[model samples]
Target chain A: EAGVTQSPTHLIKTRGQQATLRCSPISGHTSVYWYQQALGLGLQFLLWYDEGEERNRGNFPPRFSGRQFPNYSSELNVNALELEDSALYLCASSLAFGTNLPDTQYFGPGTRLTVL
Target chain B: SQKIEQNSEALNIQEGKTATLTCNYTNYSPAYLQWYRQDPGRGPVFLLLIRENEKEKRKERLKVTFDTTLKQSLFHITASQPADSATYLCALVRPGGKLTFGQGTILTVHP
Candidate 1:
């Protein structure tokens, strides 16, 4: 089966500009999560979407937001991008929530966002 | 606040040896813990998951041990090979569906 896929392998944007990243979950998966990994840093949670609803989000600012579509695809929008916003944005997908079994998340290669 | 920590330094070991990595957490009671492998410029791939009730889990050459009392997890690779070289990440899944990840431990196996 194909794993989660993300578009725009690399993106370059200037300060104060906006950037959009997209992710398509694996087939039959319903939950999509967004994370940011800065250079020499760990994965920082950004947002979680399930069944077209925003279930949770991380400590990021309001300028960082995203939405999940009906087909379970997701889009992450970063507004007013700053130099600190440069990082690899990762997307992961898992089975529907509330299941008895543990939900193992599968991730995509990620989009490298470079903010100048 | 919740915090997860993994060894920031990279580990170097010769092939055919055992590689052990550690993950520690603070201020969080997770229901399940998971390990993932990630190479440079690539996303993480799930490896193993151990629940609070289970003390240990194994898959092929990989073994994971979870200690609830200490709030830590240990991942081991037996007879490690150069192919095992990568950043191993530990993640904690809370009561809800949220998952928090550690900084990751970089393991380099030499021949």
Candidate 2:
């Protein structure tokens, strides 16, 4: 089966610009998650979307937001990008929770975002 | 605030040896701990998951041990090969399905 898929393998944006990253979950998966991995850092949770609802978010600022579509795809929008915003943004998908689905999350090849 | 930590330094070991990595957390009671393998430019791939009530889990040559009382987990690879070289990440699953990760530990198995 195809794993999670993300678009725009690489993106470059300048300060104050807006960047949009997209992710398509694996077939039959309903939960999508976004994470940011800054250089030399770990994966920081960004947002969680399940069943077209925003379930939880990390400590990131409001400028970082995203939404899930009816087809279970997700989009992460980073506004007012700063140099610190440069990182590899990862997307993961799993079967919706509480449906007796195992908790293993399959990740997609991340998008490398370079903010200048 | 909750924090997760993994050894930032890269681990070097000869092939056929066992490689062990550590993950520790503070101020968090996770339902389960997960391990993932990541290449230099790729997203992490799921490796293993151990629940809080479980003490150990193993898959093929990979083994994971969880100590809830000590708030720590250990991942082990036996008879390691050079192909196993990569960054190994440990993640803590929060109550509501969020995963908090630690900076990964890079493992280098030299032939």
Best by lDDT: 1
Cα RMSD (Å) per model? 1.4, 1.6
TM-score of 1: 0.97
Docking class of 1: medium
In candidate 1, which residue pairs get closer than 3 Å at backbone N, Cα or C atoms, i.e. clash?
none
Say which candidate scores most in TM-score.
Answer: 1
Off by over 4 Å in 1: A99-102
lDDT of 1: 0.93
Model 1 chain A is weakest, by summed lDDT over 10 consecutive residues, at A95-104
Candidate 2 structure, TM-score to reference: 0.96
lDDT of each: 0.93, 0.92
* Model 2: per-residue Cα lDDT at residue B78: 100
Q: Estimate each model's TM-score.
A: 0.97, 0.96
Cα-based lDDT at residue B32, candidate 1: 93
Compose the digit string of candidate 2's lDDT tens values, residues B70-94.
8999999999999999999998886
Candidate 1 Cα deviation (angstroms), residue A106: 0.4
